[model samples]
Target: MAASVEHDSLESMEAPQTAVEVEETKTFKDLGVTDVLCEACDQLGWTKPTKIQIEAIPLALQGRDIIGLAETGSGKTGAFALPILNALLETPQRLFALVLTPTRELAFQISEQFEALGSSIGVQCAVIVGGIDSMSQSLALAKKPHIVIATPGRLIDHLENTKGFNLRALKYLVMDEADRILNMDFETEVDKILKVIPRDRKTFLFSATMTKKVQKLQRAALKNPVKCAVSSKYQTVEKLQQYYLFIPSKFKDTYLVYILNELAGNSFMIFCSTCNNTQRTALLLRNLGFTAIPLHGQMSQSKRLGSLNKFKAKARSILLATDVASRGLDIPHVDVVVNFDIPTHSKDYIHRVGRTARAGRSGKAITFVTQYDVELFQRIEHLIGKKLPVFPTQDDEVMMLTERVTEAQRFARMELREHGEKKKRSREDVGDNDDTEGAIGVRNKVAGGKMKKRKGR
Candidate 1:
């Protein structure tokens, strides 16, 4: 406890010094980034450094370990990537750096950023995560990539089992989303990983909030780190217009459809509390003729990545996701966010709403608050330091949606039950190939029952 307090004080005291120094540095080149990397940043359309990048890049270039505190969408990846790429340039070697992330999605996203930034230098990166074949990963490790981005559990699996592979000469280590990494209870695996990596390597820890677990991890991992905090307080971006809708739990789907129609032509992300709810709501929306998709922990990794790619490509306009998509995965063009279920924790409210209004763009967020979620909604309001205005709706117009939504709900439930049976049978007869293509075909066969739009809202 005493050490954590001392660490907090030290971080607070040193945070401002770097903030003051960052003002004079306007560009990545000004922050000691190499000419090649600056050009690569230009090609990627990053004209200027973000706040986190501006603060951490210069210090990292000077060979100092760093602890960065920044919110989601604050360009934390660039802050750590630039320094690691720069170091690799000066002293090029395979397996030069390792980044440990909390989720497979986040790990893949980081690898994409690294490859983009280091395109000119021919930097190779391997993503090691779960739900994928380990045999293929063994081949990737055999080829000796320059950087390895991974989750803790799978990385430990490789360290113990993979033949002729090690990180004894690694020069840099990064734990992105350090707080979430610890919160998911990967502490034992993380400890095991730390025991093997070289203590002389530089470590950079980036997290949204500083929890006790994160503070403890900082002491265990980083060495005399300089703290670079962009926003220590929990708050949403200025361009976000947040609102709430209070309705009965039974009428939740009706209100959701009304809102989607009201905000047509805009891309949306809807947050749900459970995987089952996410899948059910997605089927319901799809039956109503909306371009809806589901992303949850239960799906195969290829399907999960396919869902994200389809959403990003705008082939699908609505993504119904559990909290798995909430943190550290960047999809920059979201125009609105809907909290279909209010988060039990207030801090998640910030991250969910943060998905939109990103990078100085204007966006909206509407949260659905059922009677049972009053206390949760109030806690969210308290955390954000303001009461959300009610989203205007004509009760009669919403009521008109009830019959159509109810019909769609019936179809959705039927499809879900049939899909579950198919999955079970497939697992017994063959491998778990549970293809969504056949499921969608079935929906098309029953498309005659889908309700047509009622005129004159």
Candidate 2:
């Protein structure tokens, strides 16, 4: 009964009748954003503001604390960034704003967007996250970049340890993906951060959903924030074609290979349930001569960024990842999202499929459901409020590749075992403390070449 009541309350929050309606075609200049930032927006190809931006920007410029509830792929970044940049232009202060994200990849992605939008104005943003070196990050913080983007735990470490580094005068605080942050159980760190930052600052909390924890944090962090909600209900866009395939558990790899062959010219972001599975799938796909890369929690930060940059640059066509990539890392050219393993939680299904069909581009999401996954699959359908159509498959052709897939799977398993052993040996050789929480190795640098002179801007 309590769950049902909570569900109803969620429904009400999602489809609120009293929410402010924003004009879809509103421009940034009309939203009271300065002409210089408007030029930055134009350079980034944002001719008009998104719905969330339209609603939040004007109020944000008016100095209102904001709680923006919008779905994945919505322009939540811009809704917070433009206003922050606009404010930075006025004040021109270092360590002006702090943007907190859930994951390292999301932190990097947000930093990229902030840099791209603030480039013309010479905005420097530092990213602080785990699996990266503290010394380098300390150097970055020493420089006192105008903006600091960080994950909670790592940021807390710095706050406590890094000398002469504090956000005492921070003008703005943004909790991007606030729901995920709480879900990851970073409440203690967030509480610590809240205690340290000045109380006279503007706070913007943006989340895909309004949960009890987010509400609690909002009350604690914000002072009468304006609610900007673009999507009150959980639903995929019309352009996303979602489908499911019921197959035997053992033949999952074969089906994936068959699908990749069938959908040849398109890039794919395949979701797996475990880090081992992600690595195995990438190895399997690569063994078959496909340019597949893996990203998961266990990987070092540099490799993770390398994989993401490779995918973003189209150097790799297929990316196999765990839920780390699901929430906020936006890759523009993902043509298909293959759920190689159906998510256990129904809500995760929404985020996994959200990778594609973003920013008005049509895309496909296919989920593999085994006999044991019927109940879970049913739960996802119930959550989405619709029955998914069956994705067409050639079973005979899929069976034809089973032998090759089995051999590849064996190779993948062996590789995983060897990799695990190597990790175990390394841990034994160099005590665990050597890999400090946020310690990062040298990044793989891009090759430098002579610059071709360009015409004046």
Candidate 3:
């Protein structure tokens, strides 16, 4: 079952001049949402409106541009989806909305939520992201889906090359995770998109924090926007039990294995710092008989989605990922989040922990802090304005797993070397056939011939 949006007690961070206070108990209908969307919301098990939804939907329905600031899991999707679908109900058109996201997985997730919310209305969404065949994405764009969810780079690729495709008639523009988009340095691509789209469209900018870049974007894109902020400070939810494990750097993996065995039945999202580390950690865990999957930027788009779906379905007990999965993804049953690698940026720590303990559910987050990471970890604690208590562990039990863990690590390293060699050979075989300049045919050469038909949106 889908998790319902609950009322959060956090106050708005920085209310803009046009901001309006939303009552806690207001339903979707009370926020001036239409009946059809309300029914769709009910079907999705969103019985009560989240705080952002309650505050933003009414103004959005009134055709006001908005800047929504909230934590990752505070129902930001519902806040934007309802208003866009409702407007689609009134003004039926192809390419009605364009949602720009930072990552490919997030693009697909947003498309799923849009389709689920507007399923009765037959809302079609085309996801355009990198790491897949561009021809297929071009075809999806040619179909003229009701909403186009895309990353900046891939969308620009299509806009320049995909004939008969344009967003001149687009009515709504949503920049989900606006801060992350800027952080990833999509400013030029975003500018090009801004110039290409219609000037009189309704724009919504949603971000966890209002950074300087986001503010500049608001000035350039939005007109007299209303600010709807759900959280006034950087803080994790109360339901999340945050803790840290201080261990020697060499024994980090052993401590991770020990903790996983200690809390054996719970699902885990273990965050690594790099793609290679994520892959290696996943391989090591799998070799030790754990159902662990890796999701990182290096994998193909299909494989990434497969990993996410497998974890979501409980087919896998562990999800090993980089910061790519740290923001704006709503996976409801994540029982724990392990920071195997502490995030360098203090702000990212908040987003990483926000993945679990969502929607009124209790969860745990354990950060692995080594001697080298003390300064970074301290910065995180200071930023969050609270010191996390140490998570209890038995040193003898942790050391007991060291022998098996060392063996698994050796195996993982071997597998990684072989995988890297295979990729090198594949790329070398492709040689001149690779479209380096246009990004048209840069798919995984190993699976290039087995192009599967993508599921319909």
Candidate 4:
């Protein structure tokens, strides 16, 4: 009887969470993938491949140039990785594969995936990134890895100075997040790096967003590529519990804290609009006796690395980060995602929430909505083509909301202190200017009055 009541309650929610999209599944062996790869997949507990993987892997193994457009977390990496490994397993010598990513995090991530896929067998992998010494990178390259995963700037740096990168022997090239790496203002660097590579190679491109800039770059990058589109823009995650809390603007943080304390998991991310907002939110969360950390662009490289390490280790339960810092970073065991600040880009919302509900797991995506965030939320909903349901908390959750009120008081005090300091500084500067101007004028007026009094006497 209670289950029926709860089911009705869930159903009444506007954009209720649905089940995952049904896609046809096939085993790796059934897809014509090698037994060695199939064995690894089974070992990893991957019984069957995703739709994108099922379609793209066979085409890739055929040595065909392909353009794969899929949603974030659609297992696109495996689509390319499996085929690359199969091709390289035949000829293990010489650097044969190059994958370009926009960020260093992704470079390391892809390199790790490549290593993992070939761990049963033997596959040599090298990663090119910045903020590290080139000597170490050169050393990694000197061993002549089978696959090289790299960011554009670091690749260019290595090409201009390092001698180990031999593109003539390269047989496969992939631009992961092709729009971010291959086009935009940053694309000039990617274009220059592309010119350094041999054109007679099998090219693979993948990204969440496919703009005209990417299409033009694709023409120049590939030799008549095959296009595959899997997910459309703003596609909703069916297994995710999607809802919003319609609270007053001032009480948003309170309501958010209420939900966070009630949720039954550790290791989650809160999306913020900017680095400052992310930092401020982290500090607020920390003040509430919860383990929270901030991630954003303003943070130093070492700090960002440290934050992610801590997050992965479960040292921090909640990570308050902006979208820019969170991109291309895949963290395991993220239980829930909170949209503290609505994403400026609708696509970013997809990436932010994709952190959870990954690898056949059920997760919840909760958003705190205010008047300020309504339009932005609408944009997100419109893009995803779903109206989310409104969900209110239970009785035990009320205490957490009280704690958030306390936190808001602290935030107000902090803001007031900053405002007071700014006003104090401005008042002091104005006082000094007034004193300087009065000095000469006061003396002249005094002298003239004194002279007039003496003459009258």
lDDT score for residue 150 of model 3: 91
Q: Please give each candidate's TM-score.
A: 0.91, 0.89, 0.90, 0.78
Put down candidate 4 lDDT per residue, 218-268, tens digits, no spaces: 888876566666765556567777777777777666776777777746567
- Encode model 1's per-residue lDDT on 1-457: one tens digit a residue: 6546755775777666556766677789898999999999999999999988987898799887899999889999999999999999999999999999988889999999999999999999999987788899999999999999998988998999999999999999999999888878889989999999899999999999999999999999988787888875888888999999999999999999999999999999999998778888988998788988888766777777888999999999999888878999888789999999999889889989999999889999999999999999999988889989999999999999989999999988987776777656655765442222112111111112222321111
Clashes of 3: 0
- Which candidate number has the best TM-score? 1
lDDT of 4: 0.72
Name every residue pair that clashes in candidate 1: none
Q: Can you rank all candidates by lDDT, best first? A: 1, 2, 3, 4
lDDT per residue as tens, model 2, 241-350: 99999999988999999999999999999999987788889878876767898887767777777889999999989999888778898887899999999998888898
- How many clashes (backbone N, Cα, C below 3 Å) per candidate? 0, 3, 0, 4
Provide the lDDT at 61 for model 2: 93
The candidate scoring highest on lDDT is 1
Error of 4 at 413 (Å): 9.2
| Model 3 C-alpha lDDT per residue in residues 1-457, reported as the tens digit of each score | 1111111112234344224344444578888888888888899889988788877887789887889998887888888889999999998999999999998878888999999999999999999887768898899888999999999988999999999999999999999999999998899999999999999999999999989999999999997777787787888899999999998999999999998999999999999998778888887887787888887766667777788889889999899988988887767788999999999998999999888888899999999999999999999999989989999998988888999999999987887776667777776777322221132333332212211111121
Query: lDDT per model, in order?
Result: 0.86, 0.85, 0.84, 0.72
Instruction: Give the lDDT of residue 288 in candidate 4.
Output: 65
Global fold similarity of model 3 (TM-score): 0.90
Q: Least accurate stretch of 10 residues (summed lDDT) in model 3? A: 1-10
**Candidate 1, overall lDDT?**
0.86
